[model samples]
Target chain A: MNAEDAGANLAREADESHGRTVAAERRALVQALILVLLTLWTFRDEVTKSVAQASTMTQAAHGLALPALAVMLLYCRRAELSRDLQKGSWWGAVLIILAVLAYAVTTWPFYVSYVRKLQFVTAFAGIALVVGGWRILWRCGPLLVLTGLAMPIGWNTYSTLSIRPETLTMDTALKALNLLPDMVVRLQGTELHYVHAGVQGVVGLGDAHNGLAAPLALASVYVFVTFSRVRPAWQSAILLIVAIPVVALGNLLRVLLHACLTVWSGAMPAEGLPRDVALVLSLVATYLVVAAASIVLDHLFVEEGGDSRVATTIRR
Target chain B: MESKDIVRTGAIRRLCSPIFGTTALILLVAAVALDPAMTALDIHFRKTSILPRVSLSAFDAATLPSFKSAPKESPFLDPHPDDDAGTRDHVLQRLQERDANGTDGQVILFVTYYSDPNDQVPHTPEVCYRQIGGVVRAIGSRTVELGQGDWPKRVEVRTVIVEQELANAAIAYVFCANGRFYTRRNEVRLALGWPGDKRVYFSKIEAVSRFERDEQPDLAMARACKLLSEVLPALLTRHFPRQADLKHRAVGAAR
Candidate 1:
């Protein structure tokens, strides 16, 4: 197979059931989208009334991020989805009618006091559309259903960052600060207020107040980018999990350094010689550092899964 | 995007009907109709956990409190022994009407905003707009500290009731000082100043909630007296010393 064939094969080999499922999803999305519009148009009175009292409504129906991600997942699976689009069941109208009725009933101020679990209706509709679309249409679009899970799916994790790396971040950074000649550092909480008694505070600078979030966020983004390339589902998941701490530690250290610089310079003498400016530039520097680190770590860990379907795909 | 280049598809499409297509289209329409208005609702009550304890638990029918704009100063104080301004006595007299009318509690939280002329070091014409504004917002009142609220002598002791829900609802005080929330009570003093300023230093604690009013009588009284001690100075400072003399003393002492 040529490069194009190989790329298609990788996607084709994802899982037969998943491939067919995504192909059939298009009609459903279009159907659902249309059904929603019709129900809304038919019941314009209810929709209008809710707008008048929108400020005091019960249950938030809008979570843009989750729906947007779901839509994207559907789009990614568009390659295999168009074929199976016809095989899906059609309870779309019934759901549309039910959701509108639920919405209309919930609009009354008294419904807010009722024990109807008021938010349940819209949540059910959103889930139905996403999961149903995913099952009927096998594209990544349905995977966006998982994004909504973010609300209730928090978990305790093991990571160096979670292990209270604030101490380690500060200790390593402060040790580096102490090595400098004639530098007096005073740490108040996370702030390292340094007073310089050397050379009329010669115009100079060092990493005292570098922000910590940038390094951590960059590390996370880097690991994600690496995982998408070599493509091991398990390694990708593990790395994604581990990268949280790596990035978090990087961020804590950055903030520590950011505060340290303030002490180093008695006052914000110059705009460029400030922590705020460092924050802007540190983005690129950190991305480079994090990307390099992940590339190295990813290569070190990537094993030939000869028995695994994922490993065989890469060999081709 | 063609049918012949097919890899795989979901079983629902193969197992389901063209009629479901209509249903899918219908639900899509419903989702569109429902989501727009639903998304528009904005709830700020959720921002503060303490608000529910105070306002939420209050009988829903409880309307806004009856307030007659008492003149800016507390009317309880005996007339200033001797003063050029004459207005200090006038300001103190106003609080008497509310007291005489038998309003069970008179608790006024004010945010005075001005550079203290008497502040040592002259602190560079410092400003506390955010800090003051934050306090004003937090307490759900409005105040402008331009002229006479800092005079300490204006403070007086009032009754205290500790177990009040509204009183305890004063849990988190947020102020943006130097672009940071000065959240703690000790931190509040840096910008709030001591009672010496004409207004209540932190004086006059009334049990705003029924629970606290009934539960901790002594603690409430102590808190009320403590509040009066702190607040009266700040309020009086605003008027007695007046801005001109106060600035001279503060700036001059530094010099």
Candidate 2:
């Protein structure tokens, strides 16, 4: 090949490389600016108060861990995200506009309430769409949404919204207590009075036993994690479907265990080593339930057949 | 390019594309709808919870009691006193009143109200008091019959003896909805039901009286209850709105 022709080709290549570098730099700058704005918006008064006083330490801890988990998930799926950058659709602008509108509406006096953080999620998703496009959203939507878990919601809010399910939980716990030999359970509201051998024990299922919020928060993250890992569409769907029950069963176990402890120890103290023990026990029970449900889901759905090698591995 | 063309041809993409944004929007709406917070109906109650507008013109400060509101200097004093600000907001009105009427220590009155069934009613002192740097020694609930009204209400008050490091205190609190009284927080909540528009406006009259370390916890509780019985009735008449009162006032105004 001639030297002149080779030099011309090299100059064209350099120009192309410079153009790509400039585009990447611009993208990075835009992302940084968006992050700065989001940070300013998110750490406002209401959100700060909520985060500072997250309902429970367990919740706070999980919430704190969510960002890291999301990052890890993103890193794990970097290949997919990299491949997805082939095109940036105009629909991203639509998402950004919708999210900004939502954020604006939520900021209004009457609209700023329990679920205000959801708008922040919407906004972040919008930013992702604007920056990385629809495929980025489809790939990273759950992770972006994972940031919502960081927003604090009190368990009492659950009691107000999901009173029926909580009442059911309390009732089921009462029934379980009654089924225990020599344990007579009487219910008044969410309180269960256990009378056995002249010892009367009263356990009031307060906001802590509201039954939905904690489990829902935990299961949402778990399902997101499961989805990030498991590729099979139907299996992930099954896991998603089972999350509620798995969480509910764990909560039920907590209530029943607390009742048993009350029956044995007499008068559940409000705050002490005993209360802490019960909380830890409840968490353990919840994780165990989740694990068991996951195994069952994997065996029944993901593995195809009961006697299959996959099912055997799942069983083991 | 069209959304379909840009969206990758995959099972997950196919599943999510049509419904994901819609689902998220629905989820947000459902949360706001089912949620007990930030709705138009509850906004009035939410505002009231923060700063209840009870006309205190009738309350003659000189004749009734020589009580000075707790000084702003108290370190342990909470700016937002309620356990859950998201639920109750400013409804849980707290006052640290220094009494000149021969009471040994200050009287702390924590008045909490919930008009929405979705609103947060006050919990037992064991749960509320014990969490805020107080060690609870004994907790009990009993019905205390107060006043000779058309409906002779037997109000259930939970008495608690909280042992703080600097001092010890006894607290007696009762949960009441409209004119009706409930023995427990759960009972009040159950009575309220799950509605954006609440049927009853509930309030908890919590009275706290501190004492010397030597004073018996039971004695402190009795004094606290006495102080509560005095303050609560008047506060209830002033602060918490009643449907019956509204009806009665409407009738009187018509005449």
Candidate 3:
């Protein structure tokens, strides 16, 4: 064959090979997408129910915000994720298998809403792994993880985690108020009793007022969403570590103010401000504390070498 | 377009292969099969009350039964107003009856119905009692026989023994959903969670009565059930569809 003809043949062969690679990539993407879509569609009822419950229930208000935030974060990171796609993992098959088994188990309907959603998320993660391998999972996993907030951590769990911490916060509030003259404060479980100038002020730190669940939930969302932006392992760790105290302190402040109001007003009117309005007031205080803490943390943990430590740690 | 030709395509064939394709098909079927039919039971009707006033001889014999409508002003503050703000709020009827026997017997019958399965049955008396400044000490469940004879009807109820300072009382309530009566919370949840189960109108019939501190909740519940039983059949027939009552009763009567 002539030299020019041979070169043309080689060029055609290279073009064909590239086309084949692109086709393969497309196939994998389609497979992954379809699997995830089907899994979500199958569990839409569970998802809807959990969302509805979360929206209605005061304590689980985080459930509604989480998925939406996660979606936004995912959208923000889409470019980076697509740029960082990696080859499929054999280990991903193991995840897919486990997820399938979980899918089957969750079908029984005996599991609570959160457990079912947890399983569904696991299956989605497994599908992602099988489709795009480990890199895609690590890059995109946080968004999937955030979807978990859509499911409420069961009421029993909420109660267990809330009661002690709230009681502690109330105790701390009483101690802080002890310095103030003409105020007598006593705490019984989650109930607060105050007698100032013979005016009895009683406030109960209920599930909504517990101040534990919302802060933890909000903090987790903050950390996970900012996982990409925050630098170093220690900063994210510090953010998580400080979340409880910030939340507790905010709650303490709110309760103290509320008690003071009760003492001054003799009592909140029988109907009082709605429970939800009160919860929002506390949450506003919590947001301020969290925001201030986040600022200080951001300054302290300035990104080094433009790399996230958790991402690096996962790689290792 | 031939079946063999389609089967020869590697992608289609691989997906349709015994393991993956079969598994997918089975799972899809299982998901559909297991999906709760009542996840969002939708019934569209705008009315004040689903249940008619059930005035019985016994209720009248004890003392003339007095019917009082739930207050309309500031429904959010009221215990349960008929004009609840929640669009999905269950249709509720609250009537307070005084015992005519001069024994100072007072009973409050609170009837609630849900047209949407997603609209949950209201918080049980355990929660309701607590919300209303009462301390609940003991909670239990029991089945009460309402009718006599070969085909005797029975109603299951949850009893909450409550104490508010000097006043002592018992709250006995039954939740009838999809035609099945559930006294306990878990039973109702399980039935509602069951995959593809049809959603139907369900009612929460709650009767609250004053009881002596020494009286057992069982006795109070039995009395409540007897009083409730007088109107239950007629109420169920009027409010719930015949099929829901018949099918659920047939399947769950033994339980």
Candidate 4:
């Protein structure tokens, strides 16, 4: 063949090869979708119970949004997933079997309420491994962790763990509220007594007020860490480490806002639309703070790249 | 066929291979179906092993000699609200007494009976007090001696002092699960959840007394403890399920 003819033939072959890889990736994704659906269907009851708890319990309300956030995180990485898709391994089947058996034991012989909820996450991971292989599982690790965190903290567990944070939140809120001119806020135990403009009211900082902000803040941090492409596990660790005080500050802000509204209105709206709105606003503020910190970190630590000036100078 | 058609057909055939596709579907279906089947099995297990207990409604609070049933209105104390009716039975009472010091001592008695094995550990004074805007200052367990002929000669009860903005409360409570007394919440959970004897039941008897700034918690604690000792024996004998009945049920299920 002439040179022109040979070149055209080679280009045609490359097109065919590219077509085959794309087709294979598409098929694998469809299969993975089917597996995910099956896993979710199987664990529908647990998910429903979790959703109900998240809706009613203030401490777990953030759980209602986590699943959707996880899906969004996965969606953001679609390009990476499509590029790295491959045939799965038999080990995924082993994981699926182990998770199913553990779920059965928890369900029939002994009812471990919390552990049974966790099996939903394990089954999802196993499904991901089965359909998209190890690379996909690695890529989707943060989303999986997010899904696990989405499970509602059981009432017993929340009651046990919330005491210290609750006390700290109350104390910080009291301090902040007192800073307002013409507002004298006093905390006696969990109740906050406020006086402003000759108006007096008492806001009882119950379970509803104390625990929701921290978990909501932590969930928001994970969302940021997942979406912002924060690198080097240590950086993510720092973000997580700073999240505690951020959560405390957010909770203090929520209490101060709620207490102010209660004092001004001459009624204690401890739990209702006003309190919920204040909580959502505080969470929004928390997210903005976290986003600003993440951006600062991004600027402070630059990732070394092949085209970087420093790398180019070293090569020269 | 053209080469392109051949490649497309080959890909479809590989993707839809019957053996591999069928096995994957079967495995997933089995995993999906496992929970409901096992939950059915659990229902069967619960049906056979559940013990019969006298309902809390049958226990008349007025029958006690030293205490009379007063109105259930307390500023600092309220019953822990539970939405799931099927899981537990709750009764709240305000008991009143005129102490020897001429001070009218009032105690709020809250009792709950749980039979559902899936139910979590019952809320304790530590959690309940906090829910009502009270901070728990101190919590510990104390042994209270019951009168003669009581099934348990001595019982350990959790004692907590809670401080609210408007008032302060001294509280004491104990859990009777599987015919034994327990002070801690986890102990009660373990006893009720033990698979050895599946006849699971637990009752929490809690008493709270509100004291002012002038009075110490000792007075409030003494009043609560006094009420607990007077009422605990009656509940064990008259209200709770007997150990003999549980064994009989087990034997019948075994047969």
Highest-DockQ candidate: 4
Candidate 3: pairs in clash: B34-B195, B35-B196, B62-B100, B62-B101, B63-B100
lDDT (tens digit, per residue) of candidate 4 on A39-108: 6666676778888888887667767777577667767677678777777766676776777777677666
Candidate 3 lDDT, tens digit per residue, B178-232? 6678875556655655544443456677776666656565555555565566546
How would you encode candidate 1's per-residue C-alpha lDDT over B149-253 as one tens digit per residue? 333222222221111113221211122221112322224334333212222111111211111323544432333233334333333332222333322223223
DockQ of each: 0.08, 0.03, 0.07, 0.27
A253-308 per-residue lDDT for model 1 (tens digits): 45445545555555453334555544544445555655676555545544533355
Per residue, candidate 3 scores C-alpha lDDT tens digits across A1-316 of: 9999999999999999878666556665666656666666666776677777778776667776775676677666655566565666655556655655555455444444445668766766666676667778877666675766556676544543454455566667889776688888765434456777777767654532334655555554455544545244576577667766665665666667666655665665332443344546766766665567666766554444355763463333
What's the C-alpha lDDT at position A44 in model 3? 70
- Identify the runs in model 2 with alpha carbons over 4 angstroms from their true place: A1-43, A55-61, A154-157, A208-211, A267-269, A272-282, A285-316, B1-255
- Order by TM-score, highest first: 4, 3, 2, 1
Q: What local distance difference test score does each model get?
A: 0.35, 0.56, 0.56, 0.70
* DockQ score, prediction 1: 0.08
Among the candidates, what TM-score does chain A have in each?
0.45, 0.73, 0.70, 0.82
- Second chain alone, TM-score for each candidate: 0.20, 0.59, 0.56, 0.72
All candidates: interface RMSD? 16.0, 12.8, 7.1, 3.6
Give the range where candidate 2 chain A is weakest over 10 consecutive residues by summed lDDT: A269-278
Worst 10 residues of 3 chain A by lDDT: A269-278
Q: Clashes in model 2: which pairs?
A: B49-B90, B49-B91, B50-B90, B70-B96
